[model samples]
Each structure stands twice: as structure tokens, then as C-alpha cells.
Target: MTRNSLAARALPPAVLVQIPATSKANAHIDPGSGSFFVQMSLVGLLYAGVAIKPYWRRTKAFLTGRRSTPEADDESSDS
Candidate 1:
């Protein structure tokens, strides 16, 4: 067998055993953190999409040599 396959075979059992062994360890995270991170991630994604949209369209048009239509901003209409 190859080195990667042998190594992969070796690591999974250690990972599996270590997790349950640490289950009773004291760890605290505020419940708000999960929701805050979720909201921030969603907002960041939306903001990124909004920010990148024009650049994406411009790059697509440039690479594909297609002119964007004035009436239809995106490819939502039936051609």
C-alpha cells in the first residue's frame, strides 16, 4: 500500500477515541455566540454577493464577449 493510505488507516481510530474521551471536559460558550455568528455569516455572504455582483457580471461579459442588455439586468428573462 501507499504511504497516504497507510497513514489514513492509522489516524481515524485515534480521532474517534479521543473525541468521546474529552466529552466530559468543562467548556463554556454563550448561546448567543452561535446565533451571532450565524447572523454575521449570512450578512457577510449577502454583503459579499452584493459587492461582487457588478464585478462578476463585468468579468463574465468580458470573458464571454457578451454584451449585457439594458432592459434585462440579469438572465432572468426568456430569450
Candidate 2:
């Protein structure tokens, strides 16, 4: 369509929309959730530790500044 025809059929300016304040939510916020979050985080950490347990010896060695790899440990144990 032509620009002039489009301009003639243009809609009126929109009103500024604003949300009206309403009463507070009636939902119950659990006060006991702080402990639950702490417990869940601890459990997650424990689970992570357990999941990586096969690599625990290398992990500990690496943290203690050891440069040896798991293969080296296995070779030494075979001697």
C-alpha cells in the first residue's frame, strides 16, 4: 500500500500502561527453608565427593603439591 494511505489508517496514540498496586500475596513462605538449603548444599558436596572418589588419591596428591599422576602411582605400586 501507499505511504499516504497507511498514514491515514494509522491507529491513535497508545495510553501509558501502569500496573495498579494490589493486596499482598496470600502464599505461605516457608521459614524452615534456610536449613533445608544448607542441608541440600552439604548433600550435593558430599555426592560430588563420592562421585569423584575413584580419583580421590590423585586429587589429594595434587592438592598437596604432588606432581605425580595416577599412572605413576600404579607403576610404583607394581614394583
Candidate 3:
């Protein structure tokens, strides 16, 4: 058999892609819904964590040896 024929046999069959559900024009938003509240809470927490990550990293660096502490003057005064 040829190399091209061997390579073609090794490949798997093509898969069918599934389409997701689309929102209809008549969809309504209920304020007392549980799913909406859960989704909003998760999104809010995700955004908050992403926004504060840089500040958290800076604070962690100060706690570790990676960055200098602002209390250096206090330590010097104590000694």
C-alpha cells in the first residue's frame, strides 16, 4: 500500500457539531428566579476576584520575600 493510503486509513471519521439553544423573542426575565440570581452572583464574584487579583498579588509579595514591606521604618525605630 502507498503512504497516502495508509495515512487516510489512520484518520477517524468526521463528527457532527451540535448547535446550542437560541433565546426566543418572547423570552421574559423574572426577578424572583433562582437561576438568574445564581448566574448573576457567580458572574459578580468572578469579576470581583479578577479585578482584585493584582492587588492581592502585591499584598502577597509584601508578605513573602518578593517585595519590600512598608513597616521597615517601624522595625528600625524598635532597634
Query: Among these predicted structures, which one has the highest lDDT?
Result: 1
Write candidate 2's Cα lDDT for 1-79 as tens digits.
Answer: 2342233224221211123538865769764778756765654444344334436657777889877564543331111
Q: Write the per-residue lDDT of candidate 3 for residues 1-79, one digit (tens) a residue.
A: 2343233233422211123447745658655568856765654444444444445656777788586344431121101
The true-versus-predicted C-alpha distance at residue 60 of model 2, in Å, is 5.4
Clashing pairs in 1: none
lDDT at 62, model 1: 83
Candidate 1 Cα misplacement greater than 4 A, ranges:
1-32, 70-79
Q: In terms of lDDT, which candidate is stronger, 2 or 3? A: 2
- Angstrom error of the Cα, residue 79, model 2: value is 32
Candidate 1's error at 4, in angstroms?
A: 49
By TM-score, is 1 or 3 better?
1
Please list the residue runs of candidate 3 whose C-alpha ends up more than 4 Å from where it truly belongs after superposition: 1-32, 67-79
Q: Please, what is the whole-model Cα lDDT of each candidate in the order they appear?
A: 0.48, 0.45, 0.43
**Per-residue lDDT over 31-60 for candidate 1, one digit per residue giving the tens place of the 0 to 100 score:** 576885676565444444444554567777
For all predicted structures, in order, the TM-scores are 0.43, 0.31, 0.41
CA RMSD, predictions in order: 15.8, 24.3, 20.5
